[model samples]
Target: MINKKDIKTLIVKKPLTLDCGRVISDFPIAYETYGKLNERKDNAILIFHALTGDQFVTGKNPVTDKDGWWAYAVGSGKAINTDKYFLICANVIGGCMGSFGPSHIDPETKKAFGTKFPVITINDMVNAQVNLLDHFKINQLFSVIGGSMGGMQVLQFVSNFPDKAKTAIPIACTSSHSAQNIAFNELGRQSIMADSDWKEGNYQNQNLNPGKGLSVARMAAHITYLSKKGLENKFGRKLQERDDLKFGFDADFQIESYLRHQGSVFVDRFDANSYLYITRAMDYFDLPRKFGGNLSKAFEKTKTKFFIISFTSDWLYPTQENKDIVIALNSIGADVGFAEIESDKGHDSFLLDVPDFLNVLKNFVDKSYEELIR
Candidate 1:
């Protein structure tokens, strides 16, 4: 229920050139800012959000009645320490939250773009953000930080614009999407497209929405976001609003209630077609080939400092992946640090209130800032 009134849109004709050899014309990128840019324009920190996150990262979402997604780690004195840095968060180019995507009207057909939105790559996404930065007149950023898909963008940003950022932090991310990971995303897309109500991504005008498909997709994806230990600790065999088990697919356990809540809420805010587009973009992201088919060559000239973080229990992108990235960075003799925080919270731990992660974030930002100022 985002109030169209408060939302401001900036449109760029042919904003991003897709890796699929198509150009996204007359695109709009939705963004929100916190704090003030310094006179030198060097205090700006770009914060990238994951698969489902929007521009509303830290502040309260007046439109949804829910607290901002990363409120716990952002804000005045939080881990990001916005009070000390100029924070910029934008909905990725292919996202649905106020950004141009399938739901947007296609000037060519005078209809919703729907599934016709050009396929994009993570580099394309970072390239769009660079265009937005140009529009804002930000020549350089203090740091770029993100998790999950957001982390993928962070890494791509460094690879694409190595000299533009003072530091880059890619947490809970990998150098490339694995076949197994791509399979998971493909299943989600299949769920959405398989729904009878999807109507080939034209459901919006057909008076039908692919809520069931989107919800099921969300449910399956949500499981990957948490750890088995976390699930057991939070909702192990717990009954759901009942004393006796009259199990007939009626949410017999607390875990079922949790997953149902995640799925239902996800459908209300997200567009099914955009989900397919964004995930496809992530699947197509790989830097080795982009860097002339050698991962080590990507960072060969990057002067930007890097801080790679991962979690022990994150099965989605394990610590091994982070280590491989570190190895590549080291092979190029890049200034990089790796911190694999011991946590059982899984991939979602990056966004959660993990004290260890917070300490690392604070330390990395402070250290990077000191290096820049000195």
Candidate 2:
């Protein structure tokens, strides 16, 4: 059985080559593991988190004092069934939570990397995870599963390491960011850069942070994660503890109050520069482009079984986008499954409590495990 320990942070001493020709050396990766790896080590399942998610996937987050982001879908006997599989989740390198990012210190200058940090792509994040897996001596993964930005990493992992994972699941994401998606990310980045305290991404040096700007950015991005139907169902024209309009800009509506709260809570835990870097990485992600405009070529040699999912209300990554991925996989005769669930939960449905989604996930993992053992 694998020994359980507190969240572990490992420093990769070797230089990591990036697509932009930049290199990162001696960077730290913070991760948390659930369950135990058996003697064979073939039962390992690597889970990649969303854009803002961290290593804490199924337990109490020591830093946030809150339940894990995906507690409902992962854990012993949950959809992922930690009891049957060794689950691992790590903070992506271009992330703020316990991974190498703009918030990390550059050994050369002894200051936060900030804008000075080399630009990273989804592939870079997957490369970091591969290095981490190498550290653990795990040659083949039972499965790789993720949604949203995490799903992007899932795609990257399968494309770059075709023989590494036996099964791959990418949910509510696309191989490349859509024009609308890039516009939304650009808006968030602009919000941070427009903040007066941002100080041109050197706010750390001035002992100031762009809390307000980052908060606004979070508020804006949070809107995209929800569908109009879901938002109306949750907060539809409700007032925020007020009887009527106050005739002022002090959050007269319940939706406004809820969004403000999201923004406020986010700024406390995430770095503005990290937000900038991670969003840029997403905007630059295009698996087909990297493989010379042949999406099928990216997975032609892969033996991995893929299960792709999309939510009906997820406009950020609509069902058509997922269908496109399925088509590409089909073109190459790759083993694949596609599910477009009927849900009003929007792009965030994968992370929320959706019975249908969870059941699908559980069945897929169970079947994959069954095939592995046979």
Candidate 3:
């Protein structure tokens, strides 16, 4: 029940051409800002969110009543240090959170775009962000930071607009989605498509939402976000309530109950079609392929500093994947710092309270800020 006024948005009347040859005119972008821009406007930090994250980065979300996803790491005196920097986050083009997406109405047809929304790539998402930056007159960003899919956007931003950011921070992400990563995305897509209520992605007309399928998709993907050790430590074959096994199909274990709750809660806030579109975009991301099969070439012309990080237990985007990026950066002699934090928290470690990770961020940002001012 989020109205347009509830979130700050910018509407671009100019037609935006997509990578898939589709044009969207007069679209809206939803965003949120923290701190304030200085007179020189050089203290701006652009942050991107993960797959299901919105523009809410450090405040209460009016729509969900939930605290911002990165609230712990971003605030006045936190790692990012909003007191000393201007922080901005925008919902990507294919996001369901007040942004133009499959759930929004098409001015021409007067109905939701749904499946008719053109397939978008990671590049397309970055282009939309560029437009938003233009609207705000932010010629350059102090730094660009993100994790997971957001991390993909960070890589795309640095490659596509080398001069727009002074520094780049991509955590728990791969330059290209691996075959296994693509497989997981495909599995989620199939789960949504298999639901009878999906109705070929036009469920709105039938008044029957694809909640069941979407929930199953979320449940499956949620498992990939956590480490096996973390899961074991959390649930550990514990029962949901009763000590005895029900021996039935019901959720007899704590893990099953936890996943079910995650799925159910997700369906209440996200759109099924948006999920499909965003996942497809991630699967299509291949930085090396985009730049003549030379990942280093993607940053050959740039002088932007880099801070890449990976979690030890993050199988989704393992330390080796991050090292590959470091190798490419080193091959071109690009200024880069890479860290593989030892953690049992898995891919979601970046979002959790990891002291080492926070310290690294604070140190990098502090050093960069001092250098910029000097």
| Residue pairs with clashing backbones, model 3 | none
Q: In candidate 1, where is summed lDDT lowest over 10 consecutive residues?
A: 1-10
Predicted candidate 2 versus true structure: per-residue lDDT over 39-148, tens digit per residue: 99988999999988988898788877779999989988999988988988999988877778887778889998889989999999999878778888999999999999
TM-score of 1: 0.97
lDDT, candidates in the order shown: 0.86, 0.90, 0.90
- Using TM-score as the measure, the top candidate is 3
Every model's TM-score: 0.97, 0.97, 0.98
For model 1, the superposed segments whose C-alpha errors exceed 4 Å read: none
Residue 67 C-alpha lDDT in model 3? 89
* lDDT assessment of candidate 2: 0.90
Q: Could you report the Cα RMSD, in angstroms, for every candidate shown?
A: 1.4, 2.8, 1.0
Clashes (backbone N, CA, C under 3 Å), per candidate, total 1, 0, 0
Number of backbone clashes in candidate 1: 1
